[model samples]
Target chain A: MNTPEPFLGATSHTPVRHHILSVLVENKAGVLARVAGLFARRGFNIYSLAVAPAETKARFSRITIVVDAESAPLEQIVEQLDKLVNVVAISDIAPKDALERELLLATIKTDVDNRTSLLDVVGNYGAAIVDVDAGSVTLMLAGTPAACDELERELESYTTLELHRTGRVALPRLGKAAVAADPD
Target chain B: MGGLFLYLTKRIIVQLTGAQALIKSLEMEGVEVIFGLPGGAILPVYDPLIDSSVRHVLVRHEQGAGHMAEGYALATGRPGVAMVTSGPGATNIVTPIGNAHMDSTPLVVITGQVSSAAIGTDAFQECDITGITMGITKHNFLVKSAHEIPRAVAAAFHIATTGRPGPVLVDVPKDIAQSMMEWWYPASIEELDLPGYHPVVDLDADRVAQAIELIRVAERPVLYVGGGTLKSHASAQLLAFAERTGMPVVTTLMARGAFPDSHAQHLGMPGMHGMYAAVTAIQKCDLLISLGARFDDRVTGKIPAFAPHAKVIHVDIDKAEFNKVRRADVAIRSNVAAVLEAWDANQASPQNLEVWWKEINAWRETYPLVYDEPAVEGLLRPQHVIESIAKAAAPGTIVTSGVGQHQMWASQFWKFEEPGTWINSGGAGTMGFGVPAAIGAKAGRPDRVVWCIDGDGCFQMTAQELVTARSEGIPIKVAILNNAYLGMVRQWQEMFYDERYSEVYLSPDLPDYVKWAESMGCVGLRATNIEEMHAAIATANTINDVPVVIDFRTDSSEKVFPMVAAGASNDDIMVHPLQREQS
Candidate 1:
């Protein structure tokens, strides 16, 4: 019998960087479940996913998926998603090539002494105080996902009551030259 | 003037209930037959089915309906349609749906759902079938309104039949089926707003040229054909390509009839339980030109050792298939037929293959498929029984087999000369697929002969479908290789687990299959010896008015040979003991 060699093709690989996939799909019922079900059954891991109506809200929905490339090949993920009937288009956005943002909302307990300091911290991060209760204050931050992560880390010192983050949503960044070329 | 205008408009306008519209859509799509069973949720749809041109074969079980549709699709090269009620009916058919999905058979399965008001209430007989089948089906639709019926049916048929064909499910709620709507049908697939489903049929010029260049230079090339060739109707193209290039061809289980077994350039099947010459040639070949065949684990045993020395050029319609398993040197996304047609084989130059052919012919001679006579008298070998049936059957007979050692024997012993003649559950390996699939094949092609080669274990799973065949007057022949054991599992236990047979032995005489057939209103025959088996097959062929069941009491000691043990390298193929001793 011939000695078997280690087969290094598509099957053998090292985990690469996480990929940001922007998928456009028909705004139809169960479309999100279809996409999620595909990832679950195929053993593809999703780092984070966000879906909402696209620019054409009446017809299409845009889904931003942060995929753990370590679990499955990106090509396979895209191809499988493309096979879904509701999916319209898919674009893989490199971190540098895209603008990504996440909305973070947190309600934190505040006393008389810490209230002034908390307001200062919120203002420094460009966060707005949405609601102010006697013992707590609700702060909202809409910024880059990295910025939100940093803010969350800094706020760990405070007593946070409730927190919610609308996972990251992204779109390809406009080229510098294209932006400059625009007449407006 | 107002009265006249109103009267003319009223005469021109026509409205139809969703059920009527669904049936009308099927008729417009030229659907000849449907394999289905009706229930409360689907009762409304059945009312219109009675007045429609389409014929509905009432199946004994929903699972039978699904397999029949698959069999019909495999034989006729068209999308087979099956309809069932909700909940249990939907769940039962999931197996066949998965089977069709894996094999890429075109099928449209329709199921009735509870009323829209009762969808999420966990109402009686209400199941989330669309959600359940979303992963298995190629695509699925849940119609919310009555007007969507025609469009949904059109889309289901279109998606199921196009690209890499697969099963598509359409779940219609009871209320929607009873609601009224304006009747309309999409004139063509283009009219349907399916912007997401543009299958890549056009070949890329650069890739095609690169593939041909590799084929031209390779010293030893093998055409690895799969089920996609049959789906795309590329058998003629495949034959021409193989002949022009002087390359040997090996057909996968799903592709048995895609290439003629009689051809000189053809090597038999490859992989586990594959022919010795075919498996060895693939392992040693310099170029593996894969045509529409996925590198399935069964075909590529121990992927690291499979076609170790070969540079692969994989062509398939589904882009997802490329690089999903084995990386292709040249991956072309297009219909197999289109790719074959694009590669003008007539322009190919002849190359030297004398050494390759010499080695392959030697292997073929040394490890030829053979079986010894039964050690015990009056017991027939299953392989011999399959061979006997193949010999007695007509040229264009469609053969289906249930999953087991018998399925492998049918694949090995039968000689398939035309495309779409061999139908079996290849990828899913679903048991009880044979009888229903044979009935479906016979129903689809009334003029042709259909035979189901089954194992006793598999036969018992869905033998009830014989009643459906008898009642419908679709005569299909079934030959049960009664080994009284789960033959393949037993073989595995014997070889791998040291013969600790666990729940494998199904008593031979329990619920005797011959009597079981007779009880189902069909002719039943039994054959204990080789001569009797042959005579039984001949007798079954003569009687075409009703389904015939032949219980061939085959030897349980016989095991399929040329097997590369599960997860073992294809290089270590074990041939039959008799062949090994002779060699």
Candidate 2:
């Protein structure tokens, strides 16, 4: 397992790439505000965020924050967050980790006959056809935003359908020890 | 002998004017003790403190002194004074100063500057302290002359304590501190026309009524109270509004105890670190009334989904915050108290959203705030310790908490009778906040019992302040939830990651807490069981001259339940020890 870097830095070693921050919090009011306040106050450019209570308790919830900043500030983001009153802990799950970040995109297609072809394209990206009707077909995709975007690009070949996507949601491989801070 | 006396008189004259003026000004504003550490440049200021009646607590570190002053100011509802020397000494206090700015604690920080001639030169121990602290301070000054010291000190107190209370800095040059001048205390503060400061809490009542009307029509209504509620001292109004309307209240981290925790209408804190109950309630509610709060993103995760079903009514003194995130459906730009009073008198029906309340409450009961029944049965349960503290606390007593398991437990177990009774560094989540905040809270209401509930990890971070508490004679009762490690991080390592103790586990040879407290001239209580805790609390309650510490050896494995796993929806709640898989 790769040890996570300390969540504080002046610059990222790597080039620009979309980063996702998944946070677990007490399921309470103003918790979102508290979290968002952290990001905004610290000037963390959060592209998107999705929150819901975990399966554990009503007082606990999970939040996935999407960003595209240098890796340098990510550490500061995490370290500063450890001080949040409602945050239990923060972990920057690396992309290589056994994790699944999922999203569902529903779109209305005008081309009925070409729907099978669109379904086939989505299938390649691990999405499945969830609904079928006269004018539109809704496809459910579970993967990274890149995967969903690729499917959406493929679907565009057939009548560029109406589309809706749930923000990114992820789950790490459970029962694994969290990677400690890298001493290097 | 006559020649020696003449030289001594001249030396003392220069020192008496600058330092004496600052001391006189602070005392006039009712400041008794200033928390700080000394350096060469600040020695002259320290000189008058020796002869002056005002007491001074010489803190071990300058940063701790700043935090202590912040805590004292927060507790007493008066401006807290913190003194430090040049460069690192002044820089060390920056964090607490910034904290005061964010949380709006009234504080006056006096830092010793290099001699006036070395102001901008790369002199020894020199720094642009004022420029560095500009963003965090309400106002700042560099006392170039001895006469400016009195005016600057007076101005700092006024700015720090009025309106939106925050930290103000007065950098006194070394030469100025040694100069002589007539000490002048302003007869009244009414003459200062502060450019940005608004002394009165004037709010448009008509606009507030419009906000109430919007709430009356909202099907699923939610109330969000922010730090402004605490700043405005509008706890009564906030509580009354939530109770009368049967609306679930969500408090920002800075506004933790703005609403009573025990209120059935309380939905808990919302945002990223917020409870699931609050997020769900906010997401599903039709109308959200934000009082004394800015719609910070933490509360409105993915703004589109934040209170997706609701139209937001925002009430705040800062107009810039209006629609800054989730746009307000009805905006009342006013002081919290004034707006609430106006809303209370308005013509509107209390919109009944019983069905909505039922749905949210159902979600709450299924995922109640409970941990696995004490993994180790013999250990003193953290909950029991918290409950006993609550039981023993006098009515309207104030409780402050540090960031960790202890804070969560306090939120779950402590039954708050009124708003503003509970204080914590919610938004900033500053560790070691409890002791200082408790000191502040105790100073705020002298008659009330102030309980500083802390985790051992957090307590130890700023334990040096026990000296400040002792020296000041502020009788704050500290309940240390000693889990023997960074309990919260350890829990994460246990559940999400494999159990790798790493650096999270604390050492066995811990500092002698009892001896430490005693050394500071404060009482200490160590409770390995429930009985001992009760006895300790009772004994501590009887002592008024000093503070107390109660060490509770809690179960290390216990967890805060009802968790939302990372990156999950508000509906996907992990109810402790069990999963409430369905919404």
Top TM-score hit: 1
Q: Per-residue alpha-carbon lDDT of model 2 for B1-583, expressed as tens digits?
A: 9999888776333334687777777777788778889997787888778877776877777777877777666656567888999998999888788877777788899999999988889788899887777656766777778876766777788777665577888999999988888655565664442322444445666666777677777778778888888888898987776666677787766677678777778877776556767877877878778887766654565555556677778887655456556667787666788777776666344557789878988867765555445433466778788887788777887888888878877876776656557777655567887887677566556788888889888888888777777776777888888878898888778877888877898742387677777787888778776677778878877877788887777878777665555545545545555454443
The per-model DockQ list reads 0.35, 0.01
Docking class of 2: incorrect
Error of 2 at B375 (Å): 6.2
lDDT of 1 by residue, B34-119 (tens): 99999989999999998888999999999999999999999999899999999999999999999999999999999999999999
Model 1: iRMSD?
5.9
Give candidate 2 regions above 4 Å deviation: A1-184, B1-16, B50-53, B182-193, B196-206, B271-276, B296-298, B374-376, B495-501, B518-524, B530-545, B565-569, B578-583
Candidate 1 colliding pairs: none
What TM-score does chain B of candidate 2 reach?
A: 0.87
Top candidate (DockQ): 1
Q: What is the TM-score of chain A in candidate 1?
A: 0.85
lDDT score for residue B327 of model 2: 69
TM-score of every prediction relative to native: 0.95, 0.69
True contacts kept of each: 0.69, 0.00
Off by over 4 Å in 1: A1-16, A176-184, B1-11, B374-376, B581-583
